[model samples]
Target chain A: MPQKHLVEIRDNPLFASIGAESFAALTRGAYVQNFPPHTELITEGEAADFLHIVSTGCVELFSIWQGRETSMSFQTENSTFILAATIKDLPYLMSARTITKSRVIMIPSQDIRGVFERDSMFAKSIVSELATCYRNAIKTAKNIKLRTSLERLANYILKLHLAQGGRIELELAVEKRRIASFLGMTPENLSRSFAGLKSHGVEMDGQVIKVVDAAKLEEFAHPNALIDG
Target chain B: MPQKHLVEIRDNPLFASIGAESFAALTRGAYVQNFPPHTELITEGEAADFLHIVSTGCVELFSIWQGRETSMSFQTENSTFILAATIKDLPYLMSARTITKSRVIMIPSQDIRGVFERDSMFAKSIVSELATCYRNAIKTAKNIKLRTSLERLANYILKLHLAQGGRIELELAVEKRRIASFLGMTPENLSRSFAGLKSHGVEMDGQVIKVVDAAKLEEFAHPNALIDG
Candidate 1:
């Protein structure tokens, strides 16, 4: 059915230790799907029927309340999304939509449960992945609750620089508005915050950012106050 | 060994469909210990060595930043803490301390790894629990970032009340200062906020609170606007 998606589950460490036969069974039940940019893949409060693996492009995970939306996370290549809801068969707490044209592999949740029932290694991997996710989310929450909006933006910029090998030159992966939402700030405030960071040796043009003084930026960001654990 | 503390493992629903025998073997190597209030059961950034099960008393989980402390969660009777860090054998992101005289069963991380290696059902349970913890943490994060300080305190009180069957005769398990920190506000702000709530039909004496007008408080809380999912 639809060229069977050539499941690359083996690349995922969660299934790396599982027996090849079980992996084959998982692949047999999986299929590939492609969506255009801005396509809503998973909606909040909807039943989770499949575990999604992003093979290309970017996806944003976000939640909405009272007609207002906030970005929770951004998922990119080689990452899986919605595992928690899929595993529990619970309604999603956040919606996921493609930010760019994307390729994804879809694995039925029932098959995932079947594999977990039969494969200890696979199950262990799932547990480890979930734990790592939980730890990261806790860190994000701490950052949001303990730090001010400007602090969040500063730290987020530093993180992106570090993630991009200690430099930010090209256009950013997402818009300032999306990034502002991700940092829990209003877009106007984010623009003003960027202006505030200019005195701290930060510069941006369109989507491109440059940290002119890394040390000064760190001082302004309060590196010691930023969560590393 | 400290009167043996009776370290029996049960197949709690949180652990999925794992059988009692599997749980027994998983905990066969576990050890039990008792500690006085304020004991630091686990510290942030330390290597996770054991999965702790709280059998008696409450434990407060918190993180510190720039010398300011914020409460992450509180674990009470019949609950497990830190499964996420324990499963991955990663450093803990937060520190945990006993709030009252307590007993805890510590299962060595090595034994847990062995159990995962040998038991599929137990592994599934671990994944399920981790997933639940992750989702709960996400919900908490959404609650904090998307709501105002006053709304947060209102929902916090309402949630506690609901957890106690929509009545507030019971004492708050935490101090007002700790509650303020947990709600990401100062003690002074919390005091002022509580006073403001009196006009909205909320009455409190020390830790005991009574919502004289549930509908009015809910209206003030704007639960639908505050919750993400």
Candidate 2:
């Protein structure tokens, strides 16, 4: 664990608002761990032991049902994972795995709870983060319940385009299969859905997707209805 | 607005963890409002103004798309509504309407944010509440994506049965039409689905549903996979 990575975790917005002294105290017992790509960090239905803060690389949060896996979220640098399950001391609802060699700060949930009880700013930050997460979850539910596989793919492409400064030249953050599962569709359906979006003004070459007509694609995809954080 | 209603709002778990003095300050500029059945209290996509606390009666939180309505959640006595939108100062995601003649306590979102900045316990309580809501939303998303309409209904019935102390003697809390929308199906589909469940050992008399073979129903519903919250 490098000293610089420790500073990064303390500076992340999830803990940034807490007083420096309290943040330092909270992380004093924390440790940094590194995992290779494809390493399983936590398994679904297992007791959550630590509040994991992603310092570098990527992690995929997913759930398995009847032996089939569904991707729930993808966490990158500066994001935290599984805070709700850790806070509640409940079984992990989703499993987490390292998508790339990753660095993460691990703080005991008990220590985090102690800081929450003793530091007002820390608790406020926690509440704000949780609220944002809750809102995002609702948005995800709307996507799942109301939209078809094709519509979801269109929205996802549009979102990725916007996330990369309103351009589609950036490489996709995840593979097509993972994206397919995240959008609640099969790989074959996703392939067909991508072909359908092409006629609606989207052009994809491998992982690169181009939105030829942003306004027309927006109308076709109804992106406004599928909100994202 | 009765003083007793103010007391009830302050005493509800949503505000209970805030100190008594802080709670009083929260209610200082608040007011009680009454609405008749079917009155729309909050419209989706409009700017959020206040955090609502239900004092009496019931309210349905729903969303509209392409001229179709979907029920998102139902709120009753002592429950709060739209906290996520209010806290984030974002537009409401769902419209709320009175299902029965209702009394509601409206606290300005500004005041709620003020309390968060000034009180730690209040903030902590908000974190717990929001985390629970977020987890529940995730569970709902899982339900929508992983289960078919009949499987969803079967698990929903079991959940209702468990919620009512493993008994189904009481009238259903919501109508079949609303239940259909909540379960992501049409009313006609729900009717046929209910008939299908009867073959799996469920018996229904009007709103009253009885599970003649709980084990068989659980097996068909795959309760463990659906047990998220």
Complex DockQ per candidate: 0.65, 0.62
**Model 2 per-residue lDDT tens digits across residues A5-46:** 767986788788888788777788889988999999988888
TM-score of each: 0.91, 0.95
Candidate 1 Cα errors over 4 Å, as ranges = A1-7, A168-170, A224-229, B1-8, B11-29, B222-229
Number of the predicted model whose TM-score against the real structure is largest: 2
- The residue-level lDDT of candidate 1 at B183 comes to 82
Error of 1 at B44 (Å): 0.5
Clash list (residue pairs), candidate 1: none
Docking class of 2: medium
lDDT of 2 by residue, B104-125 (tens): 8898888888887788788877
User: Cα miss at B162, model 1 (Å)?
Assistant: 2.1
Please write out the lDDT profile of model 1 over residues B120-219, one tens digit for every residue: 7777777878888899888888888778788888887777667778774657877888788878889999999999899776888988888887788788
Query: For residues A1-229, what per-residue lDDT tens digits would candidate 1 score against the true structure?
Result: 3433444557777777889788877878888889999999988888888888988889999998666688999999878988888888888888899998999888888888788778777777788889878988998988887788888888887777777787646468887888899889999999999999998878989988888887888887875422733
Specify the highest-DockQ model's number.
1
